[model samples]
Target: VSVQLYANYAIGKDVQAMKAVVGEEALSSEDLLYLEFLDKFERKFVAQGAYD
Candidate 1:
């Protein structure tokens, strides 16, 4: 679920789901953790090369 959300939010560049996960008030602990993991995943893995 975390990876799917990351794929949608980062790879697809769609924030609706991420914003929904984050909510209007603030980010929850789990969401924060998932975001952290997503960041690391992109930094460490997804940026291997460029694509059109």
Candidate 2:
């Protein structure tokens, strides 16, 4: 659980850093899709109590 949380937190920080460096206008379709995938995966993970 701690590992997953840390990984998510790290990914979030990386995304924020990327946005800060490149700006939101620079985000590509692939980046949007990747973010969507992460959202769905997180939702499913929570719904299924995967961390537990």
Candidate 3:
């Protein structure tokens, strides 16, 4: 699989991109599930309120 590279990094860009957004706490199952739920809930709220 082809990988993307980030600026000034030994790792690939795709890896860096993923790393940049996530944190150590997110490694936990509870944290991950909570984040996923919040993300989906926020998106729905934003979509509903976009025109208001």
The top-ranked prediction according to lDDT is: 2
Best by TM-score: 2
lDDT of 3 by residue, 5-52 (tens): 112122333333454578544455544444454455446643586485
TM-score of each: 0.46, 0.47, 0.39
Q: Write the residue-wise lDDT of candidate 2 on 2-43 in tens digits.
A: 788657655655665687889867987766555565566567
Q: Tell me how far the alpha carbon of residue 16 in candidate 2 is from the true structure, in angstroms, after superposition.
A: 5.4
Q: What is the C-alpha lDDT of each candidate?
A: 0.58, 0.66, 0.43
lDDT of 1 by residue, 1-52 (tens): 8668656446323333565766634855555666666667667667767552
Off by over 4 Å in 3: 1-22, 50-52
- Select the stronger candidate by TM-score from 1 and 3: 1
Off by over 4 Å in 2: 1-17, 50-52
